[model samples]
Target: MKIAVCGKGGVGKTFFAGSLAGEFVLAGHPVIAIDADSSPNLALTLGLSAEQAKAIVPVAENEELVRLKTGTNYSGVFRLSFTVDDIISRYAVPTPSGASLLVMGTVKAMGSGCACPAHSVVRALMRHLVVERDEVVILDMEAGIEHLGRGTAEHVEILLVVTDANLKSLETAANICRLAQESGIRTIGLVSNRIADDRQEAAVRLFAEQHNLNVIAQLPFDPLVADAGMTGEPLDRSASSAIKAIGELAKKLRGLA
Candidate 1:
């Protein structure tokens, strides 16, 4: 299954995406976690050390790789199509959770139809992963779906929009859901994260109902999970409330598949 996790920034989209990738690995499936954020941090979330994360480069920022795939001699022209299969084999970094991580830095001005060589390469790679790859692919997308073209968005099987109880977060979630629907995605699930109490959960639920979003899961705020982020430690899969909630959501997604 190809799943995209997107929402407003700082809404815990990376946490959910990384946890779901680990859960898929535990279920005996090969998982590929893609970090499409401009400021990529999924590497740390998937258990990579700070130094290791710093050492690895993002695909869009890799001048050599992008030029190799899309560079052309003609002025201001580039190859529109190329094979990205070799990219996966050579660039995907293996994580401790048995899942591979791919950091795909954002293409600047892509939403404005920038046809630069780097943008072409990144766009092609995104399409290749969602439409061609057999393994389960989970993308921690940018703050909005504007980064995804219709071709890429339609191929994704599920889109999980995450939010907290904050009014701004819920507003962003509602906009993302509308964009996903317009992009031809049929199954859009709402995930509420970091709910501190019953009142917060109720607010999220009410917002979802008002916007016609399907609330699939609610993950309580776990202090241990937050501490791990600060200390650069991996989350405790066995004991984390957020991890358990994600595990159940993974099962529900597999069942739907």
Candidate 2:
């Protein structure tokens, strides 16, 4: 399953994506978790230590790799096509969660359709991961789907727009849903995270109903999750009810696969 998780910043999409990847690993499936966010912190969430996560060089910022793949002899030219399969084997970091991590760092001009070498490399890799790879791939996207072109986004089997009960978060999720639909993604759903009670969940469901998007999962607000984040500790899957909920959600996603 090629799943893309997106939401406004701080909506816990990275946490959800990381936990979901770990669940798939626990299920005995190979998983590749892509940190496609502009601020790439999915590494830490995937059980990498702070030092290891900080040491990661995003694909977009790897000058030597970009020169090898897209650089040209001409002063202002680059290759549009290149084999990116080796990139995974060469750079994917193995995490304690049993999932491989690939950080696709941000390109300053990414959303503007820049054809620079770095952008070209990132785009090609995105296509390779979403459309060509066999493993279960999960992308923790940036603020929206604009970073992913239609061709790449179309191949994503599922687009999960995560949101909290905040009005701004729901609004951002609605916009993301629209963009994903336009990108030709067939299965799009809303993941309501950090719900404190029936009232919050109801608000999210009402928003989803209004926007005609399915509410796929409703995760309770777990203080344990917050505590882990504050202390930079790996979430305890054995103790976190939120992680268990994500495990069940992972099964539901696997059903689609």
Candidate 3:
């Protein structure tokens, strides 16, 4: 299963993605976690040490390596087609949750129709991950669907739209789901996060119903969730409300798969 976790900024999408990766790994599936955010914190969310996260250089930022994979160093001639099958094997860092992670930094714009060597490499790697790979892949994406190439949108099994109970967050979720639907993505699941009360949960459900969304799960606003990384804890039912919610959502996704 290929899932993309997206929502408004500060919506806790990274937490959701990382938690899902853990659940998948627990279920004995090798997960490839792609942190496609410009500012990636998924590594830490996956409980990687400070040193491990710091040591990882994003594929988009590795200029010399990108040049080797694509014909970008020596000649002006650019190749749109490049093989990145070995990229994950060579570059992915192992997370404590047993998932392999690949950080894809921001792709800068050169010019209209110009071949962006870095962006090309990132896209190629993503294409291979989404279309060719057999294992479950989860992408912690930005609110905008720029990272989800239109050609690979349908290939993704699920586009998880995470949102808080606030109206602004709901508005962003609506817009993202609309754009994804337009892009030929079929399954867009709405995940309500940080619900403070019954009223907030109701609001999120009503908003989803209004937008014709499939509300997959609702995660309560547990203070423990914010403190998950501050202290280490084993993964089990003894976890926090948010973590339990995340685990349930992961199970729901697997059942659907």
Residues 28-119 of candidate 2 have per-residue lDDT tens digits of 99999999988899988888899999999999999999999987899888888789999999999999999999999984434685778888
Error of 2 at 132 (Å): 0.5
| Residues forming the 10-long window of minimal summed lDDT in candidate 1 | 107-116
lDDT of 3 at 247: 79
Tens-place lDDT per residue, model 1, 1-257, is 99999989988989888889999999999999999989898988788888999998899889999889988888877888888989999999999878999998885534696887777777888889999999999999976777767578899999999999999999999998998888898799899999999999999988888889999989999887899878866667788888988999999999988
The model with the greater lDDT, 2 or 3, is: 2
State the weakest 10-residue window (summed lDDT) of model 2. 107-116
Reference-based lDDT, each prediction: 0.88, 0.90, 0.84
lDDT accuracy of residue 14 in candidate 1: 90
Q: State which candidate, 2 or 3, has the greater TM-score.
A: 2
In model 3, the Cα lDDT at residue 212 comes to 90
Clashes of each: 0, 0, 0
Candidate 3 lDDT at 156 equals 88
Query: What's the residue-level lDDT of 41 in candidate 1?
Result: 87
Question: What is the overall TM-score of model 2 with all chains considered together?
Answer: 0.97
